[model samples]
Target: MEYTKLTLGIALLVAFAWILFRNSKRSGVLHALIRIDTIVGMIAGLYLVITAVHSLFF
Candidate 1:
């Protein structure tokens, strides 16, 4: 479970970076991809934080 969560987080982080770095170079499909990636990254960050805290405290 932990490994899965970490992998997901890493994937999202990479997606987020790609979206961010590519924004000025492309649009249309790339823009859509960026939006999706940003949302997924936010969710993954939240999940990772929550899980980490839960594990630390409980």
Candidate 2:
């Protein structure tokens, strides 16, 4: 598995989520979805970062 690509992709997802969050402040449901997406993306990004670091130094 390419942690680099996954991390980069998650970064893109977070960026996209940021854009969506800003643009969808007028809606309730969309905000909920965006929040879920952001949380998932952040968790995945954290896992990837930890795995990458472990692979590098362990």
Candidate 3:
């Protein structure tokens, strides 16, 4: 389960990087991808932290 979560976060970052970097025509996509990764990474990191805390408590 933890491995899956790790993979998800890594995969999303990789995908976003690929898409954003590939778009050589516009810088808008750069900002968009940054926003996306920021939000998603935060959520995923929060989830992991919560899971770790929960496991410790329970």
Candidate 4:
């Protein structure tokens, strides 16, 4: 996939994961969901940054 596509995909995935994590915490389904959100968000941010850098530098 192209860098833009990858970046957007990552962002959407991260958002979805975060929403799930937040909702899961309400019912006390899994305490680890928050961690998942954090990790996914970090990965998404990394992807976005990398894409931006590549677009600018390359």
User: Where is model 4 more than 4 Å wrong at Cα?
Assistant: 28-58
C-alpha lDDT score of every prediction, in listed order: 0.66, 0.65, 0.59, 0.66
Model 3: number of backbone collisions:
0
Off by over 4 Å in 1: 25-43, 46-58
What does candidate 4's lDDT look like per residue over 31-52, in tens digits? 5554576567667766776777
| Prediction 1 TM-score vs. true | 0.49
In the range 1-58, model 3's lDDT, one tens digit per residue, is 6566556656665665565566534666556556665557556665665665565567
- True-structure lDDT of candidate 3: 0.59
lDDT of 1 by residue, 1-58 (tens): 7656656666666766677666735665556555765767767766775675566567
> Higher lDDT: candidate 2 or 4?
4
TM-score of every candidate: 0.49, 0.49, 0.44, 0.45
Give, for candidate 1, the lowest lDDT window spanning 10 residues: 24-33
* Alpha-carbon runs more than 4 Å astray in model 3: 25-58
Model 3 C-alpha RMSD vs. true structure (Å) is 5.1
Instruction: lDDT for model 2, please.
Output: 0.65
- Between which residue pairs do clashes occur in model 3? none
Candidate 2: tens digits of C-alpha lDDT, residues 1-58:
5567556756866775675576567576466566766567656666776666677678
lDDT of 1 at 30: 58
